[model samples]
Target chain A: MTKQRAGLYTALTLLAVLFLIPMIWGVSSAFKARSDIFEYPPRLFPAEPTLENFRAILDGQPFWSWLLVSTLVALVSTAVAVFLCCLAGFGFAKYQFRFKNALFDVLISSLAVPFAVIIVPLFILLAVTGTLNVWFALIVPWVAPAFGIFMMRQYVEQSVPDELLHAARIDGAGEFRIFLSVVLPLLRPAVGALAVWNFLNSYNSFLWPLIVVSDPDQYTLPLGLQALFGAEGRQYDLVLAGSVLAAIPSLIVFFVLRKQLLDGLTAGAVK
Target chain B: MSTVSAQPSWWRRNEVRLAPYLFIGPFYVLYALFMIIPIGAGVYLSFTDWAGLGAPQWIGLENYRYLLQDNSFWTSLGNTVFYMSFTMLVVLPASLLLASALNARGLKLRDTFRIIFFVPVVISPIVVALVFGLIFDGQFGLMNALLQAVFGFGGIEWTTDPLWARVVVVVLVLWRWTGYLTIFFLAGLQNVPRELYEAAALDGAGAVRSFLSVTLPALRPVTAFIGVTVLVSTAQIFEEPFLLTQGGPGESTLSIAMFIYRAAFQRQELGYAAAAGVLMFAAVFTIGRIALRLFQVGRNA
Candidate 1:
């Protein structure tokens, strides 16, 4: 048993290191001078590390603007998405109504619809309507994701009790009032999970943003980095530095809410 | 009796019944407008030729007929299927193994391991792709340098070679997704009653025996959920191939989504792209529905 356990630990530790190598390498290379980035022997840490890449990208590119756009979009989307998902989740969890199952099937089945199917027509639709603004295109359409509602429903079903709703109702609490005052507080952990999920998704979203946002000034972090990567002859220095800076917020968010996010994400799948 | 005699207002009477719809109304509205309507438009647009011009010309079945003869479309579809199969076959089992190890009794720093594994996924895919692109570049890449240092041979072309390009894409997919999938499996493993394992052990069953008998069956729902999720997502894969290889060395790694993007955006073949999109949607939706039914997902709900 001791030998087997040791083997497991050894394997897991090796795998953990393997998982972290790319990010670690990216961060290390971000600090390297352009000439030393592809140096023979490829040292894990740069010998003459400098902040030149960071300064260059920050000075030349609209780095801060991209950060601002990504942050605002992610935050707004997360907030609205969390609220809508929670409300819908609470409704599905608590109430039984006509066509309930059918409605849920419709929502759930939509998950299978690939984004590629809509990319062409949706772009045309937005373009024709002249409502292809960054904020509207990025956030409004995606705020009510079916996956979030499903996750929230699973969580609400598992965590929230029926008696609480009955008790709240008996106190003359309105449906929305009960959801706001009672249910929302209990849904904090799940909300954290969904918020982190939504934030990461919106902030990191590349393809849709690439398709929709044509203006350079309206670029998100991913698009900005991609353009810089391409424009600079596939150079890694500036883009690496940009990516490292871009990753900080997402890493911080994940680290802080690791427990809730991990547990809440699996809550739906496991059960 | 006196309380019953006092008539309740219509608002009071119908509030409970109506509140649920009102709560869920916004989601359905957005779903209809964004998803249902766009899909409807896509279906309509697939039957006509358009170039973002004045009007779409009616050209029934021409786009579909062209799609039937499009080699790139066929190649992209094949590559997508290959990726989907790789995830189901390679990534799924590997994650299950990782989850089993993580679920080991009294494991040390399990949460630390879990968090570290999951960090890759939290970061943007562009960053992931960029980092990977540098590491796997055919020349001056860290991977080649390390190979030459350790193994004494490092001449393999990673991006330029068609086969190696596809391999790199799958490797990227594996690295990015395995940890994310492990969390689900770990959660499922945790929920499997410990008593079952104990009982199997008491019955003289070995570790492998108990795992096959107890663990596998218990993990079915999670496996199904992960399977369907991976299937749908991988079918629409774009970024890895798009960023890493640009679907190149001759479209060896182009995915359906990338194919659609290339056709519509780059080539301005909106009608043809819409046709391809419709076919992909039909294939994915049908398979997804079939998988859902096979697994009996949401049957209880």
Candidate 2:
């Protein structure tokens, strides 16, 4: 490589390390005692690694319930959202109907509206529907993502050809079956992308869950971790243990679906 | 081959039309129940004073009037603006540079670097809060330890000091978002044709000049997209401050979203919070539009 290109690579290496430092130090500090975390010279590794912090978080609090709630909510919500977006995307892409543009336009506009603006009213709405403290509050709102619909439409329209649908129809296959057997199979990548995206989003969501659910036992992992932080503010090891545990699923999902997720982000992500 | 059984003409026609509606209907229904109705309900509720328990007493814009005069509302708004401006300014350019570096010809081990950077985007803010909360430890934090060891500096009260509390939050936002934005820029960078760079290279244009004349203009739209996202997300920021300080150090780190949440949930000021939410929607909408326009103008220039 040329001199300038070599310099650029070195700089990029430094930035990458700078980015990774927190997680590395987090793992290092997670096993350290509260006092040791405040060591005058920060050590790269814990002096005496212990599982006590993890034990306390897992055993002491309603941590298992939180993890279960988080897992259930993320998966169910993502599935619902992806399936709904697929139906809408297929309809919008395959058929041209009355008020289609207007309806889709409204959904798209709602996407631009800030979630913070709707939180207060949505909380009340969920309460009125008697779904406030239940899993419905988590699953329902996520089931209709405008971005997912848009992406699916783009994917279906571009990839699902006219001849294929026509051929399916000529075989006397029902519209739903044609979509089920043919269209959906073609939309696998977008499905994966939306699944991963929605899962991460639903998993990380804090404000809505924090406001809607008052029950402690139903708290998600994030809320659980926050509760840990709140209860044990100075207990860095314990809090970090909860955090490290909470981070694993998302990290793994991201590593696996990074390509699909990132490509989906760039596709049909116009403002 | 005889599978094309005769159906009634009207039924067939209706099916053709209604099938699309049937497929897409649930989405519209959900959007209405979740988004449109709640938005309308929020606007209506903004005009009344109600806790979750009581019937809403109808008043005319009083909640908004109170929000306008609310000192905490103003403080939260100010802090959000401060955080948004600082992080967006720093992250956008830095991400662009990093994207450019990764996009550079003959770059090796770039995939590893990309993953390292992008990991933060997927990690929850609460986890980010946990990790950084330890780092910002007042006595023996990695930050302070480094300060003491390298420069013989004493510990700084990062979370407790109001100014430093804001600083910590800004740094956290920067760390979490910069890599996320970098990927967008990288995607943008990949779209630029190599021939443009080659053509410029032959015209006696240096790398720096070629980048400004070629790469910068090409990535303008991605920059705008990132900018608007930053504006919208930062305006709604809650977890960072809520986790790090619980809007403490005299509420210096409180974002507008945090303020709205505390109002609605903690204080039972539902109407006030809804009105504040309306204001936030308007603020984000208007500012985002103006910023997009500015970006447009910059691109055209």
Best by TM-score: 1
**lDDT measured at residue B285 in model 1 versus the true structure, 0 to 100:** 98
Give residue B159's lDDT in candidate 1 (0 to 100).
Answer: 94
- Which residue runs does candidate 1 get wrong by more than 4 Å? B1-7
Per-residue lDDT tens digits for candidate 1, residues A1-271, read 6999999999999998899899899999999999999887788999998999999999988999999999999999999999999999888888999999999988778888899899999999998899998899999999999889989998999888889999999998989999999899999999999999999999999999999999999999999999999894977899999999999999999999999999999988876
DockQ of each candidate, alpha-carbon based:
0.87, 0.57
TM-score of 2: 0.93
Question: Which pairs of residues collide in candidate 2?
Answer: none
The best candidate in terms of lDDT:
1
Report, to 2 decimal places, the DockQ of model 2. Answer: 0.57
Model 2, B186-280: lDDT tens per residue?
88888889999999999999989999999888877777767777777787888889987889899899989999889898899898888999999
Residue lDDT tens for model 1, B73-185: 89999999999999999999999999999999999999999998888899999999999988987888899998999999896799999999999999999999999999999
Looking at model 2 chain A, report the run of 10 residues with the lowest lDDT sum: A262-271
Name the runs in model 2 displaced over 4 angstroms: B1-5, B8-11, B287-301
